[model samples]
Target: MMTRSRLMLAATFLLLSAPLAAAQDGEPEVDCENAQVQIEMNICADRDYQAADGELNAAYKAAMAAAREMDEQAGEMGEHYVGAADALKRAQRAWIGYRDGQCELAGFEARGGSMEPMLVSGCLADLTRKRTAELKAVSAISGN
Candidate 1:
C-alpha cells in the first residue's frame, strides 16, 4: 500500500506539471517589460488586460453612480424626463460586446497560434483604457 500510494502521487505530479513544463520549456525569466518568450509575453499582456479591466470596472461604477444621481435630480423635477442611469447601463452593455468583438478581430492575424492571446489581451487593454477615459469624460460632462 505504501508503494502504491507513492506511485500514485508521482503520477499525479507528472500529470499536473506536464503543461507547466511544456509552457516554460525553454523560456527565461518572465519580466513584463523585457519578456523574452511567447508565454511570458502572453502572461504580461494578460496582466495588463486584467489591470485595465479593473480600472474600467471602477470607472464604470463611478459613472453609474453619477448617472443615478442625474436620474434622481430629474425625478425631483417632477417631470417625465429621460433616465440617465438606464441609458448608461444600455450603452455600457453594448460597449462591452463591441470591445470583445473588436479585440477578437485584432487577434485574427495570430489566430490559433501562441501569439493570439498576447494580441487579444493587448487589444483588450488598449480598448479598456480608452473606455475608462470615455466614461470619465461623460461623467465630467454630466457635472458629476
Candidate 2:
C-alpha cells in the first residue's frame, strides 16, 4: 500500500509539472491533436504562433528586398527615393507593437488563468498570418 501511495504521488507531481516542463523545453511531449491538458494545449498554441511568425518573417524579408530593388532601379535612372527600406522597417516595427498589444487585450478574457497563454498565442497566430499575407502582397506589388 505504501508503494502504491508513493507511485500515486509521483504521478501527481509529473502531471502538475508536465506543462511547465514542456513550456520551458520549447517542445510538446505529445502530438498537438492529442493534447488534452492545459500545458500541452498552450504548447500547441505557441507552436502555431511560431509557425505563423516564421512565415511573416519570410514575407517581410521578401518585401524589404523588393523595396531595395526598387530603390536601386530608381537610383540607376537618376531618380531620388529616400528611406525605401527604412519606411518598411518602421512599418514592421509598428505592426509588431500593435500585434502584441492586440493579443494582450484578447487574452484579457482569460486573464490570470491557465488558458491565458493559449488565448494570447491564438490571437498572435491569427494576426501574424494576416500580416504575412499583407507582406506577400507588398512583395508582389514591389515586383519581388
Candidate 3:
C-alpha cells in the first residue's frame, strides 16, 4: 500500500500530465474537396485567420500587463486586490473566446474550400486588430 503523501504526489502528476498526453494526439485535419475553389479560399481565408491569432496574442499580453497594473493600483488604494485580479482574468477569458468565435464566423463563407484556412486566418487578424484597439482604450482609461 502507498503512503498518503505518495498518493497525493501521484494524483498531482497525473493531473499535470493529462493535458500533455491529450495534446500529443493531434487535432483533426481539414478537408478541401473543391480543387477549383482552393486558390481563392486559401488567399481570402488563411490571411485573416493568421492575423486574428497574432492580434489575440498581442492583446492578451497587453491585457495581462494592464491587469497587473490595476492590481498594483488597487493595492496602493487599500482596495481588494483579488477583485481586480479576478476582473482582469475574467476579461481576458472573455476576450479570448470572443476573438476565436469572431474569427471562426468570419471564415464561415469558405469553410469547406481551400480558401477556408485563408479566410479564417484573415478573420482572426482583423478581429485581433479590433480587440487590440479596445484594449488600448481600456489602458487609456486606466492610465496604464
Candidate 4:
C-alpha cells in the first residue's frame, strides 16, 4: 500500500510534468476556458493556481505593510510592541503548510487517476483565493 505522502508526491509530479510534456509535444496553447481533455484540464488548473499564488503574494505584501503600520502605532502609543508583522509572517507560513496538506487530502479521493492533479490544483487555487481575500480584508482593517 502507498503512503499518503507518496500519493501526494505522485500527484504533484504529474501536475508539474503535464505542462512540460504538452510543450515538448508542441501542443497548442490550451484554452483554459474550454479545456476538454484531462491533461489540458490539469494544465489549466495548474495555471489558475499559479495565478492565484501571484495574487496571494501581492495580498501578503499588503498585509505585511499593514502589520508594520500596526506595530509602529503600538510603539508610538506606548502600548506593548505588537510584533504584528512577525505574527503575520508566522501565520502565513503555517497557512501555507495547512493549505498544501488540505489540498493533498482533497486529491486523495482521485488517487492514481488522471484527475488527481486537476483536483489538487483546483483545491490549491480555491484555497489560495480565499487566503488572498482574507489577507486583503485584514490589511484593509489594519490601516492599509
Candidate 5:
C-alpha cells in the first residue's frame, strides 16, 4: 500500500509540472534585452509598452496644462475659449477606448497562443508613441 501511494504521488507531481516544464523549456536563455525565445520576446514587448506609456503620460500632462492655460487666457481676455481643456479631457477618454480596442483586436492574430500578449503590447507601444507626439505638438501649439 505504501509503495502504491508513493507511485501515485509521483505521478500526480509529474502531471502538475508538465505545463510548467513546457513553459520553462521556452525560456530566453539570456537577458530579456537579448531574449532569444517567445516568452522573453513577450516580456521585452511588455517592457517597451510600459516605457511608451510613461512617455505618453508625461506628454498628456503637459498638453492638459497647456489646454488649461489656453482656457484661462481666453476667459481672462473675454474671448470664446472653445473649452479646450474640456475637449482635451473628452478626447483623451475616447482615445483610451480606441487604443484598448485596437490593441485587443491586434492580439487576435495570436489568439490563444503565447504570442498574443506580445502582439497586444507592441500595438499599444506603437499607438502610445504616436499619441505622445500628437500631445507634444498640441502643447507646442498652445505656447505653454
Candidate 6:
C-alpha cells in the first residue's frame, strides 16, 4: 500500500513530466531575415515572393485539412497530430505577413527611382526563399 505522501508526489511528478514531454516534442523555430537590401532588389523580388507565399498558403491549407481528417479518424491520437498541424499553419500565416511587410520596406528606398520595381522584386525573392525554407522545415518536422 502506498502512503498518501507518496501518491501525492507521484501525481506531481506526472503533472510536471507531461508538460516537459510535450515541450520536448514541440515545433522548431522558423528563421527570417532583417537585413537591408537595395531598392532595385525590392522591386524585382516582390512579385515572385508574393507568388511563393500564395503557393505556401495553399499547401498549408491542404495539409491542415488532411490533419483535421486524421484527427477525426484518430479518436484519441488525433489531438497531438492536429495540434502540430495547426501550429505550422499559424506560423505560415505569420510568415506571409512578415514577408509582405519586409518587401514593402525594401521598396521604400526606391520610391522615385526607375529601378524601384526591380529592387522591390529582388527583395521579395530573397525573403520568399527564406520563407520557403522555414515552411519546408516545418513541413518536414510535422511529417506533412
For model 5, name the residue pairs that clash.
none
lDDT of each: 0.88, 0.89, 0.67, 0.93, 0.89, 0.62
lDDT of 3 by residue, 27-143 (tens): 222334532455445644554456556766776667667767777777887775536557766877887798678767866897776566776676676766777777776666666
RMSD of each: 6.9, 2.6, 16.3, 11.0, 5.5, 22.9
- Using lDDT, give the best candidate's number: 4
Residues 71-114, candidate 2: write the lDDT tens digits: 77778777566457778899999999999999999999999999
RMSD of 5: 5.5
Candidate 1 per-residue lDDT, tens place, 7-63, comes to: 999999998787588667754336798888887889899989999999999989889
Instruction: List model 4 lDDT by residue over 1-144, tens digit each.
Output: 999999999999999888788799985488999999998899899999999999999999999999989998898877677788999999999999999999999999999999999999999999999999999987997867
State which candidate, 3 or 5, has the greater lDDT.
Answer: 5
Query: In candidate 4, where is summed lDDT lowest over 10 consecutive residues?
Result: 19-28
What is the TM-score ranking, best to worst?
2, 4, 1, 5, 3, 6
> Candidate 1: misplaced stretches above 4 Å?
1-29
TM-score (C-alpha, index-matched) for candidate 3: 0.54
Task: State every prediction's TM-score relative to the real structure.
Answer: 0.78, 0.83, 0.54, 0.80, 0.77, 0.49
Tens-digit lDDT track of model 5 for 22-126: 668873233666787787788889888999999999999999999988888789877675489899899999999999999999999989999999999999999
**Residue-pair clashes, model 4:** 0
Residue 48, candidate 5: how far off, in angstroms? 0.4
Q: Which 10-residue window of candidate 2 scores lowest in summed lDDT?
A: 76-85
The CA lDDT at 49 in model 1 is 97
- The candidate scoring highest on TM-score is 2
Candidate 2: residue pairs that collide: none
